[model samples]
Target: MDTQHDNALTHALAAIPGPVPPSGVLHVVIPHTSRFTVVGNHLAQHAELSLIAIGIAVYIQSLPTGTEVGIKALTARFPEGEVKIARALRELEAHGYLRRTRVRLTKGRVATRTVFCNQPGAVLRGAVVGAVPVVGPAVRSTTPAPTLVREHIHVPEPEPVAVPTAVPEEPRPVPEPVPVREAAHPPVRLPLRTAPTQPRRPLPHPRALTPELRQAASALLADLRRHAEELVLSEEAVEELVPGVAAWLERDATTDAIRRALTADLPKPLKHPARLLRHRLTALLPPPLPGIHDLAQPRRTPVTPFQTCDGCERAFRSHDPGHCRDCRAQYWEAA
Candidate 1:
């Protein structure tokens, strides 16, 4: 009845107009034997094995043998998430439609190979047993017959061969032993001595802040405190801020420019001055000057560095480093 129904469905599909083009269409062959086995299996009717799981199994079976099967590949071929494909593969394994065996490859590498079996578990097991020749052909041949037939068929026995006894012989004479030799001189011993230890010295302090650096730091702090009185910078905080500000000066940021950047659009009742100041100084820093090599032999076109434009905050490459071409032109126009 199922075969007739399948035949009718095939005919109905064939009668439809507009046959698919042969150029890009994929032909997947599903064996008639597999159709019955898969449809009639109890696992196929299971609620956990939904249509999605069945579809995934059929797709895997359709793939060429030894073809790579992975979550990423499945997701690309099927309109499903990686998680769903993984779950479907697990369901197929549970139902014995799929088996994954881990194999070690050359170069000490390992990979998993998926095995698709359309037959039921019991039939598969029986086929495996039948393929192996572990038991002798005689034993296998006898086990399939009835017990009475097996007993009656083994009546003939081979006659015992005549045995030969050994006679006693006379004893032989023993041989003499060889002599041993000793070393001529005795071994000598050496005396051991203890090594002396040296005293440890204290590490030197880091270089002190120069007077110019101190002035810049004081000016920066004064500007910050004036604009935002809520800011309370301890000596440690000042020490930390000094080096960074000094480095900015070395990079050509004037005292006034640094002051403007930190004080721009000050928030009333500032809650976190150190964090805010750190972000402004770091974000508004200018690009480093070109190196000596770059200046001496400039390329026809300089290799642009990756940085966020100060004006737009969008990442772009530019020879100017901090500003992209569009924003740089805008700045010059405004000036």
Candidate 2:
């Protein structure tokens, strides 16, 4: 439930010897397999006390070496609360397991850290030979010397002889001589190859439009206006050839962008409004053929006749027969 408590459980379980006692194996295994309750109890009763000592000792041993532990982290590892943890730590310190360095703030809280005070002494006394650096190579311990034993029981006799003196010989000397040679010349190194530069490309010339082509294009556009109510031209199409039209509209070349507007479905009368306007304007303009606008016109006569009578709401071919049959009957009734 608590961080320290949980850490304690974890630490105790971790500390349990890998090779368990035969008697406790089954119990430990059952607890390990079950919901960890048996493990928790074992930790509470046994493993925890030893581990607390270890934690405090380890913390203290680290302190003199300039190591530190936060109060929060310490509490988290201590299964018991700060009181018990502090007590155990103090006990370890008193027992010379540690040498206090200093207290300091960590994460807005205070904590005590220490180092192993007896480490140097242990190293000096050769009890922990490897603990000291200088004596590492020559610290091989002397094995106990074997004892010699003697047994009594022996006897023997001897014979006599004469001795003689004699002569000596000579010594010799040695000599050395040899020289080495080098080749006639040194070797030369080859150079590396570099990539070559490529030639540059030329730009294209602008095209010029012919007068005849321009006129033909204009006429074609006027014809299109006869059928289209809105001119929804593509940007590519305008950029390709409508320079004259755009110039006529006085749109600035850079800023006044002319985008073709689109139209939704229109009623029959409005569908060809642009066409009607184009026809009227075209007729007013001079044609390439002389008097072509006037010559194209057809003659017409004005009419003055009523095809239906307004008063009777009936059909009549002449104005004189204004009253229909239904009106005549109503007139007779009134008389």
Q: Best candidate, TM-score-wise?
A: 1
Question: Would you list the C-alpha lDDT of every candidate in the order shown?
Answer: 0.59, 0.40
Overall local distance difference test of candidate 2:
0.40
lDDT of 2 at 263: 24
lDDT of 2 by residue, 168-202 (tens): 44644432212222122222222446678765322
TM-score of each: 0.28, 0.20
Residue 296 lDDT (model 1): 95
In model 2, the runs with Cα more than 4 Å from the true position are 1-51, 58-67, 70-72, 76-79, 102-113, 117-335
Q: 1-335, model 1: which lDDT tens digit per residue?
A: 99999998787667656775667744444447332322335445654566777877656544544456777888988789997788778767666567677889999999876655543443344444443222111332322221111101221123455658867667555432222221122222223456767553222111455787677766777566765566677777766677667667766668777777877787887877776766666667676667778779545865767888888988897656578778889999999
Error of 1 at 128 (Å): 9.4
Clash pairs for candidate 2: 61-116, 63-114, 63-115, 64-114, 64-115
Candidate 1 local lDDT, residue 165? 81
